[model samples]
Target: MQPPLPGPAMILHRRVVLSAALAAPPLAAPTLAQAPAPTEAPRTLPARLLPVPRSVSAELQHRIAAPYPANWDHIPPDTAGWRALQAASAAEVDPLLPGLIEALRITVTPTTIAGVPAFDIAPRDMRPDRQGRLLVHLHGGGYVLYPGRAGAGEAMLMAGFAGFRCLSVDYRMPPDHPFPAALDDAIAAWRAVTAQHDPRRLGLFGSSAGGGLLLATLLRARAEGLPPPAAIAPGTPWCDLAGEGDSVNANAYVDNVLVSRTGWLGAAAALYAAGRDLRDPLLSPVNGDLSGFPPAILTSGTRDLLLSDTVRAHRRLRRAGVVADLQVLEGQSHAQFLDPTVPEAREAFNEIGDFLARYLGT
Candidate 1:
């Protein structure tokens, strides 16, 4: 008297369906208020300076100095005094050559890469897979400092740790040759490398001014429709030749190396720019189009005055959809990546090797 068992049609009919629909509450309709807010573009903030590390090598810590002299950049270019200063600077590092050679365990062979004077630094026991792979190094000295074997330290460490053949470009610099001179020599080296091996098998790397030049050279390569190298490592690059960046001001005297943009660093850029527009993309890769650039690995230290340059370049590369990696060491300063005695420096080179191996298969 449960009324006659519901008939088959009643059990499976529109009535049953309607009853269920009525029993359940209706879903709310989506509206603008319920939708997610659109994501806003990320903005950069001024970075706070970090305290120098207590664990830094005493040798490095001792070398730190008061802010550079106010008159460091006062000398005019191409003058006898300027020439003398450059010479003296070169002389300072000359004694360190033997030690650098020993620490890196590289054999130096004089050679010409693309008609540019360069030195080939080969590791004693390179990995078999890295046999034909090569790295072309541009030394950093603003644009008028380290020259000759004195500039080979970075390349030596790279060759030693990365197990790749390295050619350190001994490109001419200001007072004698400037601007396009360094760029031209870099390109020549690139052409030479490409002639002997596939461009995809090569890597370009440098620090500070040399790092900036590596980026500039890449811009030139793209403009000329040349094949880009497999990867590049620009360590704390002075990418903004115009001297634009928050760290340029924030880290001023805080960074012992390249102490200030208003000092010798500025003068060196002026000598290299030689009256060219600082905003010129060739001089400041930051202002250039980086869309099609090869994968890049950028290294810097928290205390480096050029930390802004490295960060900006990494951000730009990401915005352009290019593959890029940035590694910032705690409490180190400008170009500290070249110090083999520093554990951070050795790790930096290994990180670069891993990046290149992924791209170049060596």
Candidate 2:
């Protein structure tokens, strides 16, 4: 007989339990003395009977088969575990800086925007039409990691591929400052950039937490009576910090990077939010008013844990009468569009470039 379907409350309860378990510290590894003895080999299942999808790319399949830490949710924010992750990110990213700079044909100059620390990424040969156009990039790490130069990768990709002048915000995160810190930095950066460039020729974009922050920053700008950018791109945004979205449950372990809402990202959200309600428009931009917001282009993968968030944001933007476009890539995971080797990644950015070119006056 087929298994009975679960009730809504039971499903929610199970998710909550899974999230809580993920947030707890991992159990100690088994020593050789306590390890289980070898057992008789079992018969292997046929390939045709396997549940895996065949449509996914070989690159992604290899990634799926690789071993990764399963207890990342247990890592405390601002602690050694978190720092280790940050250090690993630095090791991986720092080496690529020179190559990225050369490959993208962009120069990175240290500067301060609106009194917030930032890097100006400009094409070596600036196009006359792009002189007035600017794109502010907020790097993503769930607001708890990828500090310093490590956060500049997304900005580098945009500047290189999209042929736009980009400013990457190295926003502050916890261990020093928390919620409102990143937001404050983004606003200041916007003010600083807009002070010199025409706001009408400006745009904003970021992935994951950065994407969510882009929306939060725009909402704050509206409240402050500041002019909005010509257009915006919130890529695979972490829109519902409260973890209320459907993909958070449906795509859980299926999403390779973000395995579950109750994982590191969720823990990071709790840390960044401090004691605030997650559903606050500033915290969860999906719940915010998008009326009179700027034109937007959102992107996500079919397997993204935040796919629902992207979909919801796009629907909301359209419902509010804002011009919005949604691009859902096939057989990819969260933020896989950043991969340099993927053709779809190139196409995604090219489409974004075209969108910005149309809206931001070329």
Candidate 3:
């Protein structure tokens, strides 16, 4: 009787604890089917909203910021707390740049280019068998953040593929400089490399702002009666600042990083122009006449905010009777070819090789 009387309180406490435990289940294992697919960011090209192609280097249907991410996984994390992240990412990225360049099997030399100024020239390793073609490259990163080293690695890699020498320019950057500074340096680099060389041996290449500069350089050269390049390849060029493209508004939410809106480019353009109109033909390049520009190969990704820029540029070159080849990748980012680690980038570079091979030779 004493045992039974004492048990009720303890029994009730035990029952209560058991009931609470049963109410919540242990964590379940994720299903095999839930495994994430290898992420492939799609290049954004909303067919319904694509801008009408204009006669001037294809005008953007709308200005876009950066291309957008389709999902949270694809999007970059909060930049607010990512300085360390950015630095670390840059650390990882920087090494690869050099490694890629060194791996190019190029033997750099001091060789003068034709049509370029009487300045220095840096020769990259290229097969003598494919000796005639040359690459004049402009590096990207708005106009402030990057240097010629910015894209030299990509150039070296591409040089191997195209069997051409890269005369990459280490142009002056912002703060100490502005708009025409980079353009001037780029043209000088081109001229320096082309000195004593033939125009038929020349090619022009750039990405992002550098790509836009390639167009501007061509326009300036044509205006000044400089020798024409055999071909031009502007990859994912950012050629506008009036913010007049469909992607600018439509892609606002999806693009994760800097854009035509508040991104780094607007600032770069301002500093580059030293307060000049961003739409100035020398500033935007898209505003320049397409006539007498050399044949071109324009490449862009579906998600690239600059896809419209590439499209517009290609279409304009075509309308002007310039030989233009436009390649649109399914899921690519800006200048994906510059990133050989990415599968899409490798694929893009391979395609670029084919394009350059055809244009430079035939």
TM-score of 1: 0.81
Best by lDDT: 2
lDDT of 1 by residue, 41-144 (tens): 33445667444457666545544433544565466545576677778777988888777777778788878877788988998888897877888899998888
Kindly list the per-residue Cα lDDT of model 2 for residues 130-162, writing each as its tens digit: 677889999887887788788888888888888
Q: What local lDDT does model 2 show for residue 196?
A: 80
TM-score order, best first, reads 2, 1, 3
**Model 1 alpha-carbon drift over 4 Å, by segment:** 1-52, 55-78
Candidate 3: regions farther than 4 A off: 1-94, 108-125, 256-260
Give the per-residue lDDT of model 3 (tens digit) for 1-362.
Answer: 12334566778677645554555445243233433464654455565553322321111222222244332232223333223332433454566554555665555443333332221223364466566676777766665544324335556666655566667666665566567777786667655555656877778887887788888888877776678777788887878755565565555434443433555445455666788887898888777789878778888866566777788778788888988888886544455556544455556677776677676753
Candidate 2 error regions (>4 Å):
1-71, 77-80, 127-129
Steric overlap count per candidate: 0, 0, 27
Query: TM-score for all predictions?
Result: 0.81, 0.82, 0.68
